[model samples]
Target: ETRHLTPQERVARGKAARADVPRSSHAEFVPPPKRTDPVEIIERQSATRVPELVPIRYSRMSEAPFRFYRGAASIMAADLAETPRSGFRVQCCGDAHMLNFRLLASPERRLMFDLNDFDETLPGPWEWDVKRLSASLVIAGRANGFDDAERARIVSSTVRSYREAMIRFAGTGNLDVWYAKIDADLLESLLASRLHGTKRGQKNLTRAMAKARTRDSLQAFDKLTETVDGRPRIAADPPLLVPAGDLLPDVERSALERQFRGLVERYGRTLASDRRTLLADYRLADVARKVVGVGSVGTRCWIFLLLGRDDQDPLFLQAKEADVSVLAAHVGTSRYPNQGERVVSGQRLMQATSDIFLGWERVEGIDGKQRDFYVRQLRDWKGIAMPERMRPRDMQAFGQLCGVTLARAHARSGDRIAIAAYLGGGDSFDRALTTFAEAYADQNERDHQALIDAVRAGRLPAEELPAA
Candidate 1:
């Protein structure tokens, strides 16, 4: 058993840690010596991905600086390895950029704002996530034509919210802090305050939340599935959504069904007894290869369409391949043999509410290798805040929301009192991070150009997609 300390003692310890590494030290951004080539790092990650679809990953990444940053977690990891730290750690969202923070439905059917991606989650310095979020604000602000002052304010707002939220958690009861979450209503209220009390702002907010509510499994079912010869199956959208029959020519459909059933059973065993019982009512109807988000483009992701009693009641489950987190090389390997377990464990530790059917399993690939994957409900009111659509004020408020959400997640696993003390009750930490964000955004642009240069030089293949 571990000894308990008074809250004051924890705060003192955190303040002491700051003396060893000053709060201002975080402002500096230095690339480590003999840094590995970012393009080469991307190639290494792509080696395990589907061979023909690898080009799509590069193509998506080459779109803009923010998009490039999303896929360049490996590059940022190497750079962050050289930054100063206070040594406190949390289950960091190794790639917690703006786009990764989104809306998802809680078990009670309430929409929540939380970190939605966890392909690269791991226990590491909490600053890594904050820095990535800060840089994302600057990069995305530039895309939106926000001036430097506006960009700096957005970054500062993010850090300020994080600092304040951490202090709030520190003062609260342990259980209270653990149970805390940023729900859609609370988030909308906060965003309204940031909108300067405008009627149109509230109207826009109501409209967006309403749209998010409509993006559940039923909506996805209508858009992604169709009847083929009186049987409903997932449609084929070549290079994006391909059925198992199209993906594996040699394997028979019956054999594929057996393999999937066995793997799903393995996944179900990892869920709670009640959840497994709830899942047992649904039978697998179809499976498809699904290309997902910017960073996760090349990974092996599959969608399973499950039906209960009749076609009207449906459930969609996504099985996404999990590999060693980008932070693993710098922060040490996870104890779990299965990487999917690492992702699922970290997500549970950080999120106040998680998906009902979340679980993990290792399955043999068509290439004869055993790969780890985590499964979850595919569309539980999932929605993203588009950077291109948000005004400067909206982005600032969104930044603060992400900051607060990230702080709550860190507080669950790290010492809240200590972190709050280290940050102090001032603007020093926020200003320092703002400086870092500005510098790093410049670096991201250069790195993005390098990828473009590679494409121009015929070093990498890329294709442009039509804008939405």
Candidate 2:
């Protein structure tokens, strides 16, 4: 059981694997050809114009992508109709899975946690976020080794809380929505109250809280930097992130710099005037290439670090690569002309207190490639919770918290009355979605395994993702 291969043997095995190109029987994905068919692209986007709700039926069972990525966009679009009975749709994160919610430090030094991931964020039905979040609970539960019946119970509880919270939001005043938050102290206390098994459990949670606090821009700087040849550059976490280079060729870099300047100015306008002043204190420090997330991995990304008078007063802004919204593929044309503009417009509409430095820009690469991106601070104070570690009881508690948070977010962004009316009364809507969530969880697991097989074979490269 403990046989160790010699270094020579390991090299030999690697070479053999490379030569044979091992394939898995279950893994069936043919990476689609680069999206061409401008006529089809135009038609799909044109189709997106219909106001009626689209349905997420079946994905083109391509063997190309081991996991669902852009294809999931249809799901986001389809779920839009599920918005609560009361509210008008708000700009939503578009992928508000429970795992995406996390803790972060606000400039005021308050420790807060909410929706922290936004790769798939967009303006969509407020219900889309809730459905996504609930579905994630079911999927994550299965991944955590829960039985089907248990997974259903978890999804039911999760969506029930989401439904109940929406009702509260529907009746609440705008002021109530604006002031809502679950700060770290209250969160820690709540967790402590719920995890009543033993003193050890209390201690473990307290330790976790402490760890979440130190997750800020300063922390990101240290982790991402190292001295190279007596100079500091971002440590290369290849295929995940790399220090941005100004090396897109001379003429392209010049034009890019000019466009980027315009972007900074436009983005600053998206924030409060006061926040703009704070950003002006720090000049751009460095920019680098960054790859992030399973869905967003291949998109062009840029990370910029800024310095104030001191390193402690730093700002990290990431200009993530933006692509055409999958929603557009079905929904039709956007009121906004540009996709980059659409993204920024959506974020401002959704988030209560958004980054002042939010803006959009486009530039042509030296390779004659055109890219669109929206920029924002890289790391202010950010916190992320490990979803892979939840027990059934913990999931219950977390699900309730997610419900509270989702309602607050949706209430801020969308029309609350229509959604509240749709949700009607009680747990019926919640139960219906819960049933669907359990079914989808099974589908997600099979897809995840497909991805795993692709990785095991030579089909996909191992990107530096957190191992579950």
Candidate 3:
């Protein structure tokens, strides 16, 4: 082309550039539907859309041990993308990470290992719930800086424990399986198994016992309250103690109260009549914003302290925002007609021991608010023994314990007999999962990076973002 163009040539170039351009710079970049229940549109997206989850899976790629775990979760989600599952779908704690399993008081006043988290509860495949739990073990190992080889061995031991437990359960009497539990004595035995003849390993076991001992109700009580005139009031620690966020406008508060009043009646069906009657007498003390978990940062979480007669007889309750399951997007089906019902039902199905006061309600709020939420006791001896807190040998043993626990929980909800047969006479599935976990963890890191990028670009809301 000529360096010095004619006036007509220059005019032509300008005209072409103008023609190619659209009028407006602003445009909407819509996301694909994560869950499409018409009624759930108003619920907080943090309750469902877990982009942080994907990123978490991806973030550990910088290190060698975690390199393999990157997309392990995404792959687990994909492998569980489609499968025929038990028809008896109930609201399940969608991400049943081994850490989420903890010591809690049963109705009989017996302390038992039970699931304590229900933030992402939704109705969906039983397998999806378990696989998510399994992958968590692998990711957790990487987070603690375990090497690939160590992580692989831990994952193997974990799955093996689950498979072996299922086999044992299938052959044993029902009552025996129900009676199966891990107590302090069982934990001691597990430590002995892990320690073998090593003095170093024995020391690790002692340390674990000391750590676990410090995590009882007394420990929780100290942190949960300070004695005020020999009476208990929630400690004023910003949002932690304060159950409600800010004073709701009278119009909004009245609507919330009205909906919650109906909630007691609807909640009755989720439990036995006696407990329902007990909850009916309870009065709401206050409601406040609450943040929970590394993944569910922006969800509309609130704590409501209920008082039956006075403050000492306090019952803490949480109404985490409920949304459709992530698995629903891939499966192409909603497990239940009502999302609130879906959550409540799944909790009943999956949890061997459940909070007596679990229930749900739909409240009408201002600022385009009409949201449904599932409610449950905030803390009932909820304490988790972190994996990193254990020695290598003890970690292996603990992994097995978690596996057995997972299998038992699954057996309760799904066809354990059939699953046992499917896994007969082989460790191939265990090995395959180990491989899958390592490989996919790498993928997760990449996805996490995409999330970090999105956050930096201000593509997502600030509340929705978590510290990487």
Candidate 4:
């Protein structure tokens, strides 16, 4: 085992990294001569997903450049492989775009702001996540009709927040760093100040928080289920939400339910004894195949409804198929053999807290094929950010929150001292990333247009859904 270095030595090591890979080197983004076609990457990924739902994925991505960026994590993974690195590795949220940062409830029911999606998580260069996030801000800013200067300022401020936060974490104790979190009260105060202390801004924040609290399993039970013969069943909304029974004949459906029950029991074994016992109180009532997110639409996702004592006390659990991380092809395969376990482990490592039901299992589908899945509560005070609806100041404030949250997460798993020392008190890294973000945003627009062209031609099928 390597001996632990002194704090001064660690700082020196970080400074040494800058000589080998200067911080300014991150600004460069020239697509290689042999760069692979972005559309081809999407098609390759689609091969492993549900065939009918692939069109929905394509259609959703075709809506805007920002939307396309959300679904094109694989494409960005390829591009990120070509970027500069600080030689520091962390458990990265591989698709750490602006939208992936959101408000989620902790197990203690305290609201917190943190990275909500870990579908593409892996241990890789920390810069990859920073780049992904910075580029997303530019794309989102463009979507919101912000000018170039304003976009650059927002990206720079966000990157600066990350650098400054990392520096602070570097000076703090290990336990202190691990215990750090951005709770709801802190977020509200930051937002209030960032919004110029306006009453409308405070009111809007209050309304959004109130709305989030009502999005738990009970609320989902009301909106997503209906009483049928004195029993509750998940309502079928075809192409998006389809009941499992509707997908197969009676005989096959019965067998599928049996397999799902066994899978749930096996998954529960992976959780703590207390959580497992708590889960035992609820009995599975129904299962439904649900399409979720822009990139995740084609993946095999299931929502299970479980009843506790009576139909009124319901718990909804989601089991989402976990494929290999997009970063796997470039960085390396995960240490965990099961992809679902890979996701669960990464989430546990990075998040301040995780869902009580978070666990994994491998199940054989009705088609006799086996797949890995990570299970969690279907909904629990989850709130998503709307980038297109954000003003410049609002986006900037949201970006800062994401930056600090990401820094906290990285500090938990990586060399915080070296990373922070490398960043120093200068703004060189922040400005360089701003340049990189703009250049990558241009490249993203071109890629999005390519998808639109493919759909117009006969190359790709796209089914546009009705507006909500």
- Model 1, span 1-468: residue lDDT tens: 111678888888889998899989999986656878778888888888888778888888888888899999988998899898888888898999998898888999998989988888899999999999999999999999999999999999999999999999989998998889979878888888888777766777787788889988898899999998887899999888999999897899999999998888889999999999988999998999998877787799999999987897889999999999999999999988999999999899888899999999999987789999999988998888878878888888889999999999999988888899899999989999999999999888988898888888898876665422
Model 4 C-alpha lDDT per residue in residues 104-167, reported as the tens digit of each score: 8999999888888999999999999999999999999998889999999899989999999999
Compare candidates 2 and 4 on lDDT and give the better one: 4
lDDT of candidate 2 over 91-164, digit per residue (tens): 67776777667776555667776766554555565556666676677766765777777776777777767667
TM-score of each: 0.97, 0.74, 0.71, 0.98
User: Relative to the true structure, how large is the alpha-carbon lDDT of every model?
Assistant: 0.89, 0.58, 0.56, 0.91
Model 1, residue 126: distance off in Å is 0.9
Ten-residue region with minimum lDDT total, candidate 2: 50-59
Higher-ranked by lDDT: 3 or 4: 4
lDDT of 2 at 364: 67
- Candidate 3 per-residue lDDT, tens place, 1-468, comes to 321455345334433432332211101112225523211221233334333333332232222323323222233344454333333232446666666676665566445555666545555555455555556666677778788888778878887787788778766655666666665556557657766757766665556455554554344445665565875544555432343324354546566656555655575566678987888787765455565554443446666656677665666677776765545655554556666766777666556667787877776655566677787777655556666565556567767777777777666655455456555547755776676556545545544555445546754333323322
Candidate number that wins on lDDT, 2 or 3: 2
Ranking of candidates on lDDT, top first? 4, 1, 2, 3
